[model samples]
Target: MADKEPEALKIRREIGLVGGVALVSGTMIGSGIFMSPQFVMAYVGSPGASLVIWALSGVVAMFAALSYTELGTVIPESGGDFIYILRIYGPCPAFFAAVTFILVVKPFSIAAMAISIAEYAMAPFYPGCQPPELAVKCTAAVMIVVVATVNILNVRLAVRVQVIFLVAKVIALTVIVIGGMVEISQSSAIIVENLNVENSFKGTHYSVSALGMGFFQGLWSYAGWYNLNHVTEELKRPEVNLPRALLIAIFLVTGLYLLVNVSYLTVMTPKELMSSNAVAVTWGNKVFGSWGWIMSVAAALSAFGSLNGTFFSGGRVCFVAAREGHMPDILSMAHVHRLTPSPALIFTTAVSLVVLIPGDFQSIVNFFSFTAWFFYAITLSGLLYLKIKKPELPRPYSVPIILPILVLIVAVFLVLAPIIDDPQIEYLYVTLFILSGAVVYVPFIHYKLCPGLLTKLTTFLQLFLEVAPAEKNL
Candidate 1:
């Protein structure tokens, strides 16, 4: 044999159906359920309309998740919408998506979840007052480092941690549900009044713009249903498990979210719920009495679980983008022995920490939806394109065309409602920043004008991280 081909490191298919369900549900359940119900109530102005919003949001999410199951099966890649957009719309649109996600969406989301974890974890210590900013940030930073380390060391271990946190989250929500049901059965004066059909529906707003924004807030709570698509290559069986996990995860989460919201209403009126910042904590205090700090700890653990899922998926986006030449080459590599995408994980952790430094939680949540749904619409449109234009392509899991069409309409509504009804200069600034990626992409990615300094940096990192370029072992 003259020269044997050098072996390239391959990604291990370590995620099974259970882990897949955990990733999707785990990420969707955290922080949002605890906080977003208030936003939903505020936007809709009544407990009843908010409940409708929550139900409609779940319907929207279920439709969107089913549509994504088809896309994941068709493309069957690691970057979720990024890879789908690249294949269908081409690299330019895909670059805008990757750029927006990397710069704004993923970083702010990770930062928000980490900060939520810190606030709740510290709540028990500082009763009747807010946690210190420094202590919260320090705790968030440590949580970020720990989560990143687990992901960098081994994908399996990180996934196991996700499963554990997911169990904790479900248990916490279940207890809240059971407590609320008990209260409803007792028909306490408060529960009866709040649940009164006439009283509950008293102040529903019918404004076109308000309804749109209300959906925006409610859908945020169901945000991560498509997360499993981000690491499709690592999934055990994309065709079988992708759709199965989506169905299981969305069905379970939708029921839990609705029940949890009803539970909140059973204890607090819409106005009261809207006035409170942490809905879960308030409900816990009412149900658990003075020992409510236990809820805080539970919330923190749940947030930590979502944090791990976000890190797992966000790194894969960067790694896959690098492999596609949208990012630096070094980011595409995996550790030689551990085979984890350590470089990309570290990069995402750093960006998230920087974002956490000045993270404004509410602002991040609103705009994160603005940027996210914009790309979601684009990606779902790709599915329609394939069905019509590229009809010959293989589709292991197919959905009716109407599903994506409906979801795309909802996505467009989500993207435009906020900016149109409430014009903000920041929206213009963010749009410009996303388009500016085209300027950078042309010279750096298209023309291959990577700087000489980057070459030396890549070399140094290659040795320092012990990572080599990856290939499909198949």
Candidate 2:
């Protein structure tokens, strides 16, 4: 008689279709929708042009998500574009993807959401003036900790929290939509008069710089469309739900965003929106009177959900990279009993807290989009390469050949257009930083540098954290 072998630990497939939708749409509905409309309006210079940017941004997001469906299904793994790039392009490109995501894109994005949450949460207390910078930063850091704690505690608990906040944020947006529709129905609606054809497109900006910035800001609202891909292994049925979640989530968000923007314009003129620090609160004041603080509370909840979704997905990138030999072994481990990637999630939270100190919501979005789209273009290019070179690879879900091509074109425009219009030395530095990943990748990742130190660190962390190395789900 032989003793039964101990079962290997793996991330449970606790996320289902509804959870997937919540992760994507709830995350997409985050601080961006609450805050980005004004920035987009500022960049485009008119309600009409801003609306165009929003619609175009939605289209681009949908195309990109659909293209990701192809890759997500084919790879059937977590880690999002990092896994796709690794499979098709190789480890070097994959290493760069991991570095940017773990260091810049995900952390900057989480920081942005945290700041939004903090600003909204602290708004009611501050009254007329902007909250003190230190208070806001401290609040944001606390929020990052809370969200990280929830995620690190239990995966199922985190997903449940996501779904709850998704409902809260959706109800909040619905109130705005209903309020605006009522206003639109009234013949005396000043907002309707403002949207009259002549006024709607008034003072539209046609400059390339303006359009690029507008798209960047607008697209940030749709940033989480591919988030479910990052936790694909935790999904119950990846094939059926991956594309379905993307379609439903993205389409719903597109409609909600358009209506939400209309609602904002109905409440505030472009100048008013641009000048305002908190757009949703202002609209809520007009719509909800002294109860505008309720919107502030709602915005905080919305951003909190967005932060959790980003935290949940972003940590998996680190875990997956480590599991695939791209990162340190500690990151690839799960808590012995909890089964959550606590170490990786904590690592992500620490970086985001640092990012929150000096980075505001707007600047972070600008930088996040620059690095994000650069990797996206490469990841989608990998999809094209997979389609051509590995024709026999099983693709349970697939988009047209032209989909990734069109997305690549848009991605290239997004990466190049803004800087060409007005070159930023920051963007140049960002490029250098991205390229510099190779320096570490070659030595540490390729040559396995300093194995002894890393091994000691991994052993100590594993014991202290009560984590064991995790097995891949599939």
Q: If scored against the real structure, what TM-score would every candidate get?
A: 0.97, 0.97
List, residue by residue over 140-167, the lDDT tens digit for candidate 2: 9999999999999999999999999999
Cα miss at 280, model 1 (Å)?
Answer: 1.6
Query: lDDT of each prediction vs. the true structure?
Result: 0.87, 0.91
Worst 10 residues of 2 by lDDT: 185-194
What is candidate 2's local distance difference test score? 0.91
Clashing pairs in 2: none
RMSD for all candidates, in order, please: 1.5, 1.4
**What tens digits encode model 1's per-residue C-alpha lDDT throughout 346-452?**
99999999988976667778778888899999988999988889888888889999999999998898888777777789889889989899888999988988579
Off by over 4 Å in 2: 1-7, 186-188
Best by TM-score: 2
Candidate 1 lDDT score relative to the true structure: 0.87
